[model samples]
Target: MTLPDLDPDLAKDMQAIEIRIDGENRCLAAGKVAMPEIAKGEVLVRIHAAGVNRPDLMQVAGMYPPPPGASEIPGLELSGEIVATAPNVTQWKIGDRVCALVTGGGYAQYAAVPAAQCLPVPAGLSMTEAASLPETFFTVWHNVFDKAGLKQGETFLVHGGTSGIGTTAIQLAKAFGARVITTASTDEKCQACLDLGADIAINYKTQDFVEQVKTATNGKGADVILDMVAGDYVSRNFKAAAMEGRILIIAFLNGPKAETNFTPLLLKRLTLMGSTLRAQPVANKGAIAGKLRQQVWPLFENGTIKPVIYQTLPMNEAQAALDILRGGAHVGKVVLEVP
Candidate 1:
């Protein structure tokens, strides 16, 4: 079938929401802007939706911005149709529906993504659902699987088990044969995580997660702990981690700096690593995308690993969408549909 001609530059220029800094919530006006050019190994995409993330909220709050060499616009991942490709980008063709992990610039109607970082959208998912995949999925996959080296039959603990990364990790770890344990604040959220294949769902607000994990794991502790809350969870994560276990810290939603006892970590012979998806280099991100496509995409295609969408909002209401994300009430991914 012949594909419709799509000029990404023109599309981006014609459609985009402008966000300007102010004391209160910033303004997101619809206006034209220049679309980025396709660089080496890059493909220009006509974005259909961009996932609203916590980092986007931080950017608007003047705390987080795209790392050096990335676009100033606020977005981390997007799903769209390929419009143009730079030389040597042979893997995709025009009109191919794809989702890509981007450092930034996904908030626009058109964005340039490194060709290698693009993954074919799995069948039976809308662009909005697919848009939610890259940032959270990639982040979880890299930290839980690659960095922490979680294996089948092992026990894994994930903090914030109802958030985007948490939900994705729960499903993926279970599908891959790991025993999942997760912590959430509310009973509903804990039940949701349990339903998503978590073997143990602890309501952190009501119970001590570390003690519960110890009891659940026969006093051995978990094989891995994926932590986003770093303040108090840091020491507890070490305590809950098993001998020779690995702890991967992805985000400090509570706070980055923490004073914690390192004795348990050292005694357990644990490996602690902290990582972020957005600040990673393009090549590294591309490699992760490729690996995820090869290993995890099949699970998604088979309906084993699904994108859990909590809500969808119009791109124009980006601020409200971000506010909801920051509120932490959602159980899964929140997406924003673009024009």
Candidate 2:
């Protein structure tokens, strides 16, 4: 893996967000830390913006923690200029703008990321927009396209139509010729989903998404379902899936456990699967980056896709950004700009 070179001022300290843990209590603090040194096959990014995600909220609540050997910071994705690179890296260089998926350390002003996990920022996207891309885009692409094999003309159903993941999935599925159906909590969010190319937007607050999906499909049901709310939705997903449908679980906002009959597994030939990107090996994430660069980046460059940003705040307001995410009131991504 030949990568371009970058040189950072390692002598200077950098400002970073600290997760000060006291017993079961935790708080965010802005403090100074020594610059991170790049490792083999890694590059250091001078973060311009960091995308806040639900996992960051979960980390604050002690429900999620960074994988071993990862930074204690809570951010999962970032876009910035490459300032330093490891001795052997030759694919990225100083001043190159890129967006990367990281296990942690994205909340900080600087983060060390594997060279292969980085993708050049799309042609017309700002750093904040690019920051919003990595986490949700990678997750949707991997689960929907790579794992579930959602083909053109298939029915793709996703819950949380206003979420970062939901928005990305709707556009990508529709772009790739799939029929997108999504559920949102409000009528406005449902409209937002439709504007993003969803064929049908079900207001789950007032309607039964399962029945709506069935009716919209003429009882054929959805060919693929991306579920973030587990709990009872697990069984309901089985009911909503088409013959030999694939159901992908990416998160458990509604809880993980479900008491459901296993009959659907055999009867409908449905496949239920889930994955978390944080703990994946560098090589695994690198593979996903390559595919995104080749397949999806062009969509951005050609203006076939646009990032949906709900809010952007400065780095010191990290806690406020997380609160907005926790409240689930926003339509798309909330990001922090590093000064």
Candidate 3:
């Protein structure tokens, strides 16, 4: 496909149809937000799509704030073509189809991202699918593999088994040879997780996940657990984890406060760790991006792993997309298709 001719003035001051927060509501509004300036080692992307994530919702509710020096816009992942590049950026050029993990500002029609944070769109993925990859894949990779060191042949348990993060974790862990167990709210969602390659799917509404994990692992317990619902699960996870187990907390969906027995920490020799991706340093995210390019990208290329999108809404309907996520009924990612 031939690229469009660039009108310098239009490129200089782009129209980003952004979601503005009104009192207790988020509404889409077209505004002339300044086109991001590319610093050294950065590239300007004419975004085709942007991913809507839980953090984006938090930001909309004013519970989460963008990091200092990051864009105030509420998107974390994007798929687009490179329109311009900084002088120091040689790895990418104009017209490259790339998906990136951005700190912020991806909700716009254009985004400026670090060269190191961008990866080529995998073969056979649509721009919307590619847009869905970065945030979930990066979060799963950093938490499950990097922080927890989830090994092959181990039992991996994840909460919210039908979420963007859950779907990515299930596929990646399965691809890498781990036996995955995930918990969901309904039998339908549980089946969805099973279809995504989970070995065991627990319907948390009906079954106690601790008992399910115990039965699945023959009372040895899960070797590693990726927990998003950390409130009460914090205590229950300790009970479900094996000796020398690792638990990585990415979010507290239920609530953060919890009263748990600390004896398991000593008895199981378990490691409990938590991280928020957006607040991490650029270097850290860049490093994770590089690893994803090398290790995980092949899985996408070979069809061993792919994003499961629940719905694609036009960028102008971002709030509607977010509402789907808030309902927690969607099985995978909710993507915003940019026009």
Predictions: Cα RMSD each:
2.6, 2.3, 2.4
What's model 2's TM-score? 0.96
Off by over 4 Å in 1: 1-12, 23-28
Worst lDDT 10-window in candidate 1: 1-10
User: What C-alpha lDDT values do all the predictions have?
Assistant: 0.87, 0.91, 0.89
As for candidate 2, its clashing pairs are: 3-89, 3-90, 3-91, 4-90, 4-91, 4-92
Question: In model 2, what is the error at residue 184, expressed in angstroms?
Answer: 0.5
- Give the per-residue lDDT of model 1 (tens digit) for 75-111: 8899999988886889998889999988888888889
Ordered by lDDT, highest first, the candidates read 2, 3, 1
- Give the local distance difference test score of model 2: 0.91
Which candidate tops lDDT?
A: 2
Off by over 4 Å in 3: 1-5, 19-28
Residue 1: error of model 3 in Å? 27
